[model samples]
Target: MNARVEALIEQARGMTSEERVAALDALQELVAPPDQAWGEAWARESEERLDAYLRGDIEGEDFDVVMERMRQEFLVK
Candidate 1:
């Protein structure tokens, strides 16, 4: 590794766990920033889904039932 990265790693070692996690998150954002357009699309989709649910145009499933079904499909041998 380069000297700058080695220095940064050494500094990170001195940080608290939460501080290290914050630093890691900052580094990841620098490496690959989020897509603003995709985020906006998801926000619009979520709002539309919520409106449908509120209008009773779509029914919601129970959380526990969904989890049990997922476990049976994915975890059962």
Candidate 2:
């Protein structure tokens, strides 16, 4: 294992059980992707958008429309 990871393990070993749990919780929050609220909001939006698309409530552009739009927006030259 890497020295940094070994050092973190050694630090955790010295903590009490409660302290270890707190540390683990803090680590989990830090390691979690994009904070819970933002992720939930994004998921909700995606599900709504997908539902709309599936029901034909929302119209989607074709692949050629997408490619042209992307080229116009992103291509430098």
Estimate TM-scores for all models: 0.61, 0.49
Candidate 1 lDDT by residue in tens digits, 19-47: 99999999999999989999999999999
Residues 1-77 of candidate 2: C-alpha lDDT, one tens digit per residue: 99998999999999999999998888888887457788899999999999999999999989999999999999998
- Residue 33's C-alpha lDDT in candidate 2? 40
Q: Give model 2 RMSD, 1 decimal.
A: 10.9
Candidate topping TM-score: 1
lDDT of 2 at 9: 96
Candidate maximizing lDDT: 1
Please report, in order, the local distance difference test score of every candidate based on alpha carbons. 0.97, 0.93
Query: Which sections of candidate 2 miss by over 4 Å?
Result: 1-33
Global Cα lDDT for candidate 2: 0.93
Can you list the residue pairs that collide in candidate 2? none
